[model samples]
Target: MKLPLSRRARSAPLPGIVGAARLDIRTKNLLKRLRPGDIAIINHLDLDRVSAEALVEAGVVAVVNAAPSISGRYPNLGPSILVEAGIPLVDQVGMEVFARVAEGDTVRLDGGVLYRGEEPIAAGVVQTAESVARATQEARAGLSTQLEAFAANTMEYLRRDRNLWLDGVGFPDLATDLEGRHVLIVVRGYQYREDLQALRPYIREYRPVLIGVDGGADALLEARYRPDIILGDMDSVSDMALRSGAELIVHTDREGRAPGAERLERLGLRAQVVVAAGTSEDVAMLLADAKGAQLIVAVGVPQSLEEFLDRRRSGMASTFLTRLRVGAKLVDAKGVSRLYHPPRPQVWPSVLLVVAGLVAFCAAVAATPGGSGLLESVSAVWNDLLDWIRDVVT
Candidate 1:
């Protein structure tokens, strides 16, 4: 027995939803140009949930992925999200579609089939809720292998970067003074904006040193707070964030190849370089620890195994070591937000009472025998002062 098509599937018009399409080879770059009702053509392989969420937020009618949405390496949730959001996802449409179809072209989708017009162009596997669910189940079955690989990679990284764990190796001297101060390092991760909002009061009160890691710099700017120090490889950060007066620390490869620093130099901007073999988020933490920050509050840090995998990291070796080194000083943004409650003011009631007391005192003074005489004296003094002011003006 065959199951009937879901309401989401049947609701889509038979001749297919026709819309203007915009193509971008890079999904992240594509996001900037996306608009509601526009079809998004992207060449993303094993598309992650974050990219999928961005596409959903962009309000695209359908997605045409040139590469496989899920290659079965792990249970990626991106394709599932699209199908659930009622956006048709056409997977593995081939790379040729990029050149064959021009940008801003009107495209029509009839189920799994794509058409430029009367002419049929590209056809692909249309992902459905049921299909995505099956794929996800199969992918989850292969997690043991992924866990083994992660463990091996972690050990290898531990061996290579042992010096960092034991002693703070190659920690650079930054111009920003961080001694005995709270350092807030922002990483672009899940719910980062909301976490920043939750920490707004803490930021206003403590006035911590803000460190932005690459795209995290732009996140800070989005929240209307300027970063004091921007650290990363500089690939994802915007030009406006770079020019936001934050001191730039470009993370360089072990071989001293700094693509980010070079980019800044070409743009006639100065940047400091730190050669490290770990993720930039780890670099930011280690730098803060070395600089003697009293506390390091991290926003949008990758805390879970899935989050680490989402970043395409083999394991969380660098992150684990970085945390070990920072020890007691490092705290997650969520923890601080939960534990610290801003004081609720009771001063207004006292202030109102004092104001009422002053009014009553004035009323009592007015009722006294000398009140009229005092008022006359004050009025005469005011008149004399006014006359003097009038004379000076004249």
Candidate 2:
């Protein structure tokens, strides 16, 4: 028997694909409007894995890039992921394609050639697994230079954010007291969803102060957990997550300008504003450490050198310095999941077991000769009780 094709297989482009064109030079911005079955026209160079995953999740039928999908820049894996998902990726079709095709216009992809109606608009390379692999291998040759630049950026970051490390720079008082308690800080990165799944038992047992960093709040909501605290620029989190009664803290730079604060004001929600340098995740860790959290568990925090670079951060100095400040108390989500064996089953299960045993005993008693008379007496009492309830209703 032939089974139905999977969603990926069904959505996969045929020899010729026709779909509504959706163009965005900014891949992140474009994702907001992109719908499944729409063709995405992006100008992303060296497309990072996170953006690629977002495109896949958006369910775009195909991708048309004005820029090279992989420019031999340190083995970026975005293109390969798209191709592997059976989404056709046509790249380097020149910037003119943006001008030729209007948004919402019907566009066609005949292999690497893009067409609007009968007229062929542009042509470019169609990426494949083999080609992506070759490009990745070539990109690795440039890693040494990237490493040197990263080191210089880290040193510069340390110099600029010295006050953060020394004075705990601007930690705010929170209603949720974190002292001697575990704190879970989540960022929407990597296998954050998977990490959250692995942490179900931990969250249930410790009831840690749950903190969501921007879009990470939505991640928590998706996992069916309401955040205790939501922090960041507030751009990516949903209004539902914001209104879920989680305390909001808007992340700001040393200048104290919070972009997220204005958004909340328009929504009629109040939030505490925090000023600091570095990414919001850095701010979150420092805040948790200063608030006297005994243990800080991070989910989807960027840990590797490649991950930070993939995020296109100029320096990880703040991250490095923040980690140092929170040393001994910090633990990765993976470590928490693996090292912390789930606590023994709790009171509810024992209560359930006792209830089941009682049910069995009652049934056995009802089947016995002497207990039959007792059950009959109880049934007559129950009928009389129902009659009384009926009389009261009348």
Candidate 3:
């Protein structure tokens, strides 16, 4: 007897990629709940590289976006990364999918279509490498528009926060000393792990004041280094990192509304608040400069134009202004790691000195009357010990 479609789906082997559906509008928040072999359903548009990298790290089997992953917003890096990682991407499934699909529901993705048991719930265009490449190429034409928008945003930011750039206003006083010291600002951006590993020798020698921005604190902890100061919104940071005894400085807006402080309060911890009109990265740099740091080294901070744009227009503008404010003192980690080669101690000289001392002793001993016979007896004993060791091994 033939069974119903739902019964058949239950009894028989279900076709296509099957996993639990994890849904969230916010990509960063969604990342925390995602697990291996789970299908991620997100509403992110024009997904950036950082988010893509995090999603890839989460080991999600497939990504089903409620909106377009690439909306021709100057070739955003996310879709290509997902395609390269071999994770199945289904784009523009519409917002209805969120309502139709429940969290932790068993779902099946066959090509572009999403199925719940025997019923098809949603569908989208399955993104491939070729399709993503075409979209990226098309998106390049939109760069001029994005640049114009970025310029406008920069002007607006400069006008609103002229005091911040001109004078170090709203920078919170910190317990961690920064005067006449080398401050290392770490951001969890491109090549952060690699750059941190490369800077180990410099870190050990200089013992720079380490400042971690948000998730960068976790990065420092993972690299087995304790952060001197932890800065940022505190959304991405772990609970353990918050309780790590590092000085916490919450980045706030000009009005002094600190959302991060609330999180810390919930955790039964206190934090100093810094009101600034830029990103946490920029604020961290400005704070270091304001605190009289002699030299500032930036690790995992975005260097390239594409990287800057990937963050957003406002962020790019803030980064530019902040760099100008802290000029001559700022250095990239890549340059330092490449150029700074520490002097290594020579081992051959020490070995040679020990050999010379032994030879001198032997020569003095040989000058004595019965020294030659004594040396011969010592050599014989050494040979006997070697033979005995060899025999035991055999």
Candidate 4:
């Protein structure tokens, strides 16, 4: 007796990849639950580079997106990163996949189709490197539109937060002193890990007041350094990092509603609230500048136009204005790492000093009786050692 087509499909050599499915509409929340080799199912649209990097780091074997990964919205960087990492990406598989597939369900990905047992649960377009590139090229044509949107967003942010920017309003005073001190603000963003590694020497020399914005606190702890202050909405940061003795400053909305404050209260911890309209990164810089920081070094903060837009939020306008507010004192971590190399001690000068000391000792000995004979014996021993070295080299 012949089996049904579905059974036959399942029996016919299982050609593609299989993994446990992990799904969430919120990509950041999903990332926390994702295990290595799990099939990541997300609803993220126009995936940003940071999220893509997080997914890659999570070691997902494949990705199934419910929404378009690239909607041709100004060259989002996530798809390209996933494609380059050799992970299989199935795009726009629709939201019904969430109901069809449960978390931890074993699923098989064959070309663009997702399978459970023998039944094809969802099907979508398979994204390749070539496809991602083409989509990115097409998206570039939309940059002008994005730029106009960005400008409008900037004006909106300015109108809403002019008092905070101009008068330093809504900034909470911190116990961690920033007066005339070099302050290092770390954010968990692009190349943050590498930038942190590069800033080790500067960090050691200056011993700047270390401030970690959200997950950046964990980054500092991972590098074996405790944060002096932790500032952000407190969403992405670990509980251990919060209890790591850093003074906490929660960034709240303009109405003074701090989401992080509730979480801190749950943990039996207290935090000062700063009611601000911008992103935590921008607020962190503003805090440093307002507190009279002599120099502010930024690590893992977005530095390019593409990165600024990649944030996909209007808050980037505040970053622009914040930089202008503190541009003189602000320095990128990359620049500091590249240009601020500490002077190494010269071996030649020490060698010359030792040689001069030896000469002086020999002259003093020569004034004494039998000094010439002793000097001749030492010279002979040195000549013999040189001969031995030369013979070994030959």
My TM-score estimates for the predictions, one after another, are 0.82, 0.80, 0.91, 0.90
Predicted structure 3, TM vs. truth: 0.91
Per-residue lDDT of 85 in model 1? 94
Decide which is better by lDDT, 1 or 4.
4
Error of 4 at 221 (Å): 1.3
Off by over 4 Å in 2: 1-15, 254-261, 345-394
Residues 179-222 of candidate 4 have per-residue lDDT tens digits of 99999999989899999999988888999999999999999999
Instruction: Note the clash tally of each candidate.
Output: 0, 0, 0, 0
Give the lDDT of residue 325 in candidate 4: 90
Write down the lDDT that model 3 would get.
Answer: 0.91
The Cα local distance difference test for each model comes to 0.85, 0.87, 0.91, 0.91
Q: Report model 1's TM-score to 2 decimal places.
A: 0.82
lDDT of each residue in 1-394, candidate 3, tens digit only:
8899898877877778999999999998899899999999999989889989989999999999999999997888999999999999999999999999999999999999999987999999999999999999999999899889888888988998787777887677788889999999999888899999999999999999999999899999999999999999888888888999999999877687655667898999988887677799999999899899999999988888878877765677888888999999999999999999899989999899999999999999999999999999999999999999999999
Model 1's alpha-carbon lDDT is 0.85
Write the number of the candidate with greater lDDT, choosing between 2 and 4: 4
* Candidate 1 error regions (>4 Å): 1-14, 255-259, 347-369, 372-394
lDDT value, residue 234 of candidate 4 = 94
| Deviation (Å) of 149 in candidate 2 | 1.1
lDDT of 4 at 196: 93
Regarding lDDT, does 1 or 3 come out ahead? Answer: 3
